[model samples]
Target: MEPLFRLALLRPAIAQDPDRPSVELAQQTDFQRALSAASGAPDPRTGLRRVVGEYVAGPL
Candidate 1:
């Protein structure tokens, strides 16, 4: 069928080797740590909102 042929073309080809080290490295890296290190700062949108909201909310 034409649809089956199109679906086959769209499918991602998986690597034949299942135990690649690049896959392990991708899993091991902490996404949050990587983001923080790259920016040298906490994410501004969420962090800024929390800081401003705390001032408005007052001591709990």
Candidate 2:
């Protein structure tokens, strides 16, 4: 979650950089895909725990 938040916060900076690599873009895309899947699961608790852990531990 922290990673997502940090990524969101850094989006403008990343976008402004024309040198951004395709691998990094792909990684972001993959993160979003995983997040989307997690969001749709019946038990959101696990996702919540992940968010909390990330918030506390500063991303993994």
Candidate 3:
């Protein structure tokens, strides 16, 4: 939950950046893939935790 909140806060900052479209698109794509993977897990809580962990470990 905490990590997710941090990501929510960080997303807008990324979106506001005007100098790096490629990097921004890559980040958004990674996030979407993480979300899709999480949705496929059998347990919602475990899935979300794994997604958040992966997100935090990824480029920020």
Candidate 4:
């Protein structure tokens, strides 16, 4: 939960509106663009390492 909250703080989130019908792929932010680059996304080792590092190193 802490990691998720921290990640959310790192990027600006886009709000989805079901009422509005049109959605554009062209309107993406820098964070969204970077997230889209992930293709081989299956390494829990790296995520675990980061979490552990945060625990040991304390704050950002």
Highest lDDT, which number? 3
Question: What tens-digit string does per-residue lDDT give for candidate 2 at 1-60?
Answer: 689998888777544456765555434554565566667878767985675565567655
Tell me the tens digit of each residue's lDDT in model 1 across 33-53: 444454554576665555556
What is the clash count of model 4? 0
The C-alpha TM-scores of every prediction are 0.28, 0.32, 0.40, 0.28
> Which digits, one per residue and each the tens of the lDDT, describe model 4 over residues 1-60?
699999989999777887774666555754344344432347756655655565567654
How would you encode candidate 3's per-residue C-alpha lDDT over 5-60 as one tens digit per residue? 99988777534447655544444576777787788888867888888897888886
Cα shift from native, residue 7, model 3 (Å): 29
| RMSD (CA, Å), each prediction | 12.3, 11.4, 11.7, 13.3
Rank by lDDT, highest first. 3, 2, 4, 1
The total number of steric clashes, by the backbone 3 Å criterion, in model 2 comes to 0
Judging by TM-score, tell me the better candidate of 2 and 4.
2
For residue 5, what is the lDDT in candidate 2?
92
Name the runs in model 2 displaced over 4 angstroms.
Answer: 1-28, 48-60
Better of 1 and 4 by lDDT: 4
Q: What lDDT score goes with residue 16 in model 1? A: 61
Better of 3 and 4 by TM-score: 3
